[model samples]
Target: MRKEEKPKIDARLLELLACPLTKGPLVWDEEKSELYSRLAKLAYPVRDGIPVMLPSEARTVDPDAEPARSARSRRE
Candidate 1:
């Protein structure tokens, strides 16, 4: 049996998306299935490839804690 793959948000859509509050860029976190807004200090959940952009639905995040991928990329 073939393993089912998790649905992912389109790259183009991600590029076009921004934080509703700050209108700042968002970073995709595949593992957590969330979009992090650094400027807003929020982590928006992505469900079944659809991003939940509503501020009420978003979870607050620590401003000092960087996403794993972002931290790794910064090392290179």
Candidate 2:
């Protein structure tokens, strides 16, 4: 796959996948190369065309853009 090219996540496979924590539906973030569970506030990484579904492998996502917004404010 191209470096900037978004992974071609199969819709059918995504539909079959769920958050291991919440068992909730996940949103595919093609840009970030992750499957995000908003309910769980967790992002599962996709590496080498594989979904690392392990919760231990998952990481927390920022709930808001505080850091980015603060940096922008300082620049202005």
Per lDDT, the best of the predicted structures is 1
Query: Pick by TM-score: which candidate is best?
Result: 1
Model 2 over residues 1-76: C-alpha lDDT tens digits?
Answer: 6777666567677778888988887777766678877778888888876889999999898877212221111111
Looking at model 2, residue 28 earns an lDDT score of 72
Model 2 is weakest, by summed lDDT over 10 consecutive residues, at 67-76
Instruction: Indicate the TM-score of model 2.
Output: 0.76
lDDT of 1 by residue, 1-76 (tens): 2336555667778778889999888887776778888878899998777889999999998877757554311111
**Span of 10 residues, lowest total lDDT, candidate 1:** 67-76
TM-score against native, each model: 0.79, 0.76
lDDT (C-alpha, whole model) for all candidates: 0.77, 0.71
How many backbone collisions does model 1 have? 0
Error of 1 at 52 (Å): 0.5
Candidate 1 residue spans exceeding 4 A from truth:
1-4, 70-76
What is the lDDT, from 0 to 100, of the residue 27 in candidate 2? 75
